[model samples]
Target: MTDQSAPDERGAPRLTTREAAELLGVKPETVYAYVSRGQLSSARAAGGRGSTFDADEVRALARRSGRRDTSPAGSDLAFRTGITLIEGDRCFFRGVDATELARRYSYEEVAEWLWTGELRPGARFTAAAGTLAAARRTVGALPAHSGSTDRLRVAVTAAAATDPLRFDLSPEAVLSSARSLIPTLVGALPTLGDPEEAGGGSLARELWSRLTAEPADAPSLAVLNAALALLIDHDLAASTLAARVAASARAHPYAVVSAGLGVLEGPLHGAASGLAHRMLREAVDRGSAVPVVADHLRTGRRVPGLGHRLYRGEDPRATALFALLEDVPQAAGALAAAREVVGTTARHAPLHANIDLALAVLSVSRGMPADAGETVFAVSRTAGWIAHALEEYGERPLRIRPSGQYTGPRPPQPLPGLRTTP
Candidate 1:
């Protein structure tokens, strides 16, 4: 039994049932109801007269119960996720600084770290020969104009079809599939020469060759690695949420990834990089960045690469990437144009250049295709989606189901419903 007259560890008083009920503005029976529902805690009273509750707990409950219930439209909803945390202008993955990870670690290492909480160096991301062949054939079947992301989606679908073990949802099996899937996806893309030539190296090297004809120099490879690491995950993004929802249904990993890709293809998500690329290219072509920024702002539309919903200052990923891009000779024009845009936009708004702008700068500098940034985004985010899927798989199946608040017109009376089909 808790001491009734004595103080708590913090010197707070314990309240009797009558006192708790009075504090909460409810009957004594309601206090018991709160305890039964696990919303409040109680202890045996001194001399076994009755139960006593912590005064602080009672006060907290009272405050919560008395608060207004105003649900704003499109307001942030709370859900538990341990994947990534966006704080101020920076992002962290599992408490590790993402910018630091991008600079020091390979994409494979980062993926493993995010997936299993271990960052093993020299981990291989190789695909089975048969799976590689199947993915290549799938990519080859697409039309000539198919974008890189489209090829990736097709390859994932094909790989899933051929892997007999794809149904395994165990953590080890899912991670094993991912290790092979990422490398195979990279190798499967159509390239100028044999894709095999691009196969035996870090994922960044492999992807670099597929995106452009340039040799995988050290600096370029570093930028690619950093980009991949930075893009690997962002907590509860629309695409990641979709992936989690699918996994909550106990869908296989491949299917979960496909669901994520379906959402990532939208203009406002993964494809935002492509839009930013075009806008930056326009500025570079015009020889002055002000006009492009002015046009976008004058239209009252969001400047594609300039702002983020989460960050109030320069995006840390953008800061990291821009610092790297500054040393590359080819990036000079695009970097200068980006600065002009940033300077001009700062005068009228608070938005700053985000990772998309940095991606556009990289693509322009490297002579990659306009959609190359989106492909990088999609491939990198596959790791995050897989991680989130693993998390969702451990939860109760279909737990994300949300109920709607009905605001539509009520059903008409029988006379009005008489014309309805039987």
Candidate 2:
């Protein structure tokens, strides 16, 4: 913690390590553990405060921890990232709490910060008229029932074709491309609601109307916006890695985003939310989580959205989403069902809900189609992929190549002859 020796920027009353432990009836070491779990927030030392926690938050976490235990996360990736940190149950973007960042900024603001490491308050992204028209024209050629990701892939390609400077990979050039392409990706989609609503103030508001015909309420719209911000980046996720590899080979920014999009729908990658959406819908349909969860276990199928490889406790994104979701009247049943799913599954393991489940809850509550979570993921992850591309662009060309440890037949085996007609 930095020794600012000043009041916390948030102005919350702070507690020192010993004071917090005494209040929580735990050791100072356990106090640090609480920060790691993200159950508590800490601030730099100031006014002889040393490192401290918000008094009210620590009290709340103390009450909660008395009821259930959270396990510390186990494994971590070796890849270095200045963009995000997945520590224990929490995520941080350049050391700022991502959940908190989402609560405070628009998705466009978050994406801008990720790309340039500078906060631009009230930043807005707008696509050029020609590019939007071209992208929409290309996407219009697809079947009416085309999936969101498919439409997006086509839209990106068309946008690329229209950009005369796509080959100019300078940082300024790439940032300009991203600022246009992101909005274009949204604008290209056929609006399912009022065109005026889809033509909006914040990117999240614009995206909401494209996603569903339902009217956008302030509370629910806030949730959507926060989801987008929270998902701006993860440390070297599969799709981000793919984007970096492409960038390392000098691909243009649009192509880097396309490469990321290509890897997003795989089962082991970004498709978990779709599965979770389906499962949540079933549970909501049956009006109970019991049978749905039991059936998965009985069939030997893992319950979707229950746990995450990246976290051993709760997903902080889910925790934040659930907090915001509490204010949305339409989300009550879906949120309850999500909690039930977690409660039902936790009897057997330390499994806890992840961001996929949070997104599933959002989609299910908003009356979006089953794959809507995937759509949200793809759009949000575009920012992350581009961030990775920017980082890779600064590294040595093709620097990610790794030699294979062959476990196949010995290398000295004689080469087989070319086969004649068999």
Candidate 3:
């Protein structure tokens, strides 16, 4: 229980100078020094004791002295924040280089690295592994031959329904959510078995494992796992931003995750990969992909799988995904061909493939069903969305209200007992 009597008029509790100094981990005299420095406000004690300071003041001082402060270095924006930057050339997760981990480690290791900032080369899952298994059973009950996108939509929504504790955003809870959800969603893929066995490892690992049905070869599984890890997160994309915004409103993790799903339901974001797939399917049906692409360019004048709003030259993620797609037969030739066609026609357009286009190529090359590309995209983006949501939840409340520019009449005036003619 908290002390109610200590609070002043505004409900902010007043702390004695000793207590304030204790909170700030300084000497009692240092509290007086802080008052002299204009950093703290002090009041004369009620019963003729020394001065007392507001608890809020003491709390602020404690926050200011914390080891890992995230107050913005410099920005005019209200919530200027030090975004966790994962450098990619030498490749870092948070701050540690990921290339070393990626080369020698598994997707599970990478996920741990991303969430904890510490590279646990050998972390055992005990209870989390069991939770993942349960989630897989729930996913396996889903219709196997269902459209990948629809299945994902159904499964995620349903799984979220069963999870009552997703509202808690504690590190352990959120991490558990990630571990459980990734496997469950990934395990729900059609080829990953039905309620009986599923595959080897977690959902992300299982999905990667099933990507190559060639008797569970080690190298293939590793490549697939690497792909999943590489695709897991990106900076604040639209869906991720939506999730973060939802989280900022103190929405539950499930609701925040659902917000990402809602954004992904939009054609311009999550469905973009599906659109790219359809465009390819249309090109293939017409016998020659290049000519068909050229004709579409001539008519629509808009290239489907090229150009990005952010990257003027080339999307770095697209480049990375293309590199990962190199050995996969489903992606190898077709992606190169599509890139060539897009490059030739959209020369002036300067269109560069975004992450969606690259994922589409990878999905198609791997013989994943048409909707698999979108399913994978949604699953991958959720990681980033959850990360951003966690970040938003750590900060002060945000105010994102909408106001109209008012292109209409100022205010409606009531007629005085007479009807007006148009």
| Backbone atom clashes (below 3 Å) for every candidate | 0, 3, 6
TM-score of each model, paired residue for residue: 0.82, 0.80, 0.67
Question: Which portions of model 3 show Cα errors greater than 4 Å?
Answer: 1-105, 122-146, 192-197, 208-223, 281-288, 346-348, 402-404, 415-422
Candidate 2 per-residue lDDT over residues 34-140, each given as its tens digit: 66534567876755545777777777656544522333222111233579877767899988899989999999999988988899998999999999999999999
In terms of TM-score, the best-performing candidate is: 1
Worst 10 residues of 1 by lDDT: 67-76
Better of 1 and 3 by lDDT: 1
lDDT, candidate 1, 1-422, per-residue tens: 32354356677888988888888877777777667545678878768777888887788667655722122222212345678988767899999999999998999999989998888997669988899999999899999999888998999999898899888899999998898888888889877534555767889888887887766667777888899999999988899989988898898989988999999999999999998899899999999988998998789877778888889888999999999887777889999988888988898988898999999998887788889999999889999999999888886676666557879878773454555677
- Model 1 compared with the native: what TM-score? 0.82
lDDT of 3 at 289: 65
- Record all residue pairs in model 3 with backbone atoms less than 3 Å apart, i.e. clashing: 91-98, 183-203, 307-351, 307-352, 330-365, 331-365
- Which portions of model 2 miss their true places by more than 4 Å? 1-79, 407-422
After superposing all C-alphas onto the true structure, candidate 1 shows an RMSD in angstroms of: 6.0
